[model samples]
Target: MASVFNAVDSISAELATIIQLEAPDEISVTKKDAKIEELMVMDQSLLQCMGVSHASIESILRTTLKYKLAFKLTGARGGGSVLTLLQTLLSATVVDKVTAELESCGFHCLTATIGGQGVQVCFGGSS
Candidate 1:
């Protein structure tokens, strides 16, 4: 499923961040960036082989972190299910901004989170 591909993308992004933090020199940073790009491309190819369209896969792989989080909250289909409902309870302002962005891109952006004190909606009607 797309979730598996998404997980690979997440792991790759986290690894890139870790590498950037720990890299000692410009050469190391360049190498790390190349490796990350290669891995991401391969992951996207695998997703395409598994039936996801190029557009959907690209949107999933190339978007900002907030968009990725929004995808997770809204589900790949962008439907607001019980899981999405629970996630919205712990929302953030970035989620609101990205939700709008995702919507403009034709994906549904739900109000949600991975969990906690629930959403306070301090930043407008982000919830």
Candidate 2:
């Protein structure tokens, strides 16, 4: 269990680094850590609602821990037009990169957009 938490932390750090590297200089990225209690509330019905398959849901449930890492983007310094365009491109790139990294680690990830400038990535499975 402790190891699971450590792995989650490591993955989160790597993801942060990836985002920082990919994001433009004018974009500010903030990371929010999800509570385990929040993760625990995710049940089969909820996953099903998210369009997860039965098999995948079962596998997800069996995992002892789940994690969510949110990346919020705000323009630090940019014109309105340039900021909007940069945010749009960064959002897509972050999602694709994060999804690939998590899936390669055997975790199932769900991405949701937030406030038109942020992405919340929820993931769980065996480490």
TM, every model: 0.33, 0.23
**TM-score (C-alpha) between model 1 and the true structure:** 0.33
Top model by lDDT, which number? Answer: 1
After superposition on all C-alphas, the RMSD of every candidate to the true structure, in Å, is: 11.2, 17.8
RMSD of 2: 17.8
Residues 27-120, candidate 1, lDDT per residue (tens digit)? 7655655555455455545545665554553464455443433222212455232112212223476556655665677765444332245546
Off by over 4 Å in 2: 23-127
Per-residue lDDT tens digits for candidate 2, residues 1-127, read 5655565456556545544453333332321212212222332234344453445334434332232222221223441110011133245655566556546757655544433446666679634
> Where does the lowest 10-residue lDDT sum fall in candidate 2?
79-88
lDDT of 2: 0.38
lDDT of each structure? 0.48, 0.38
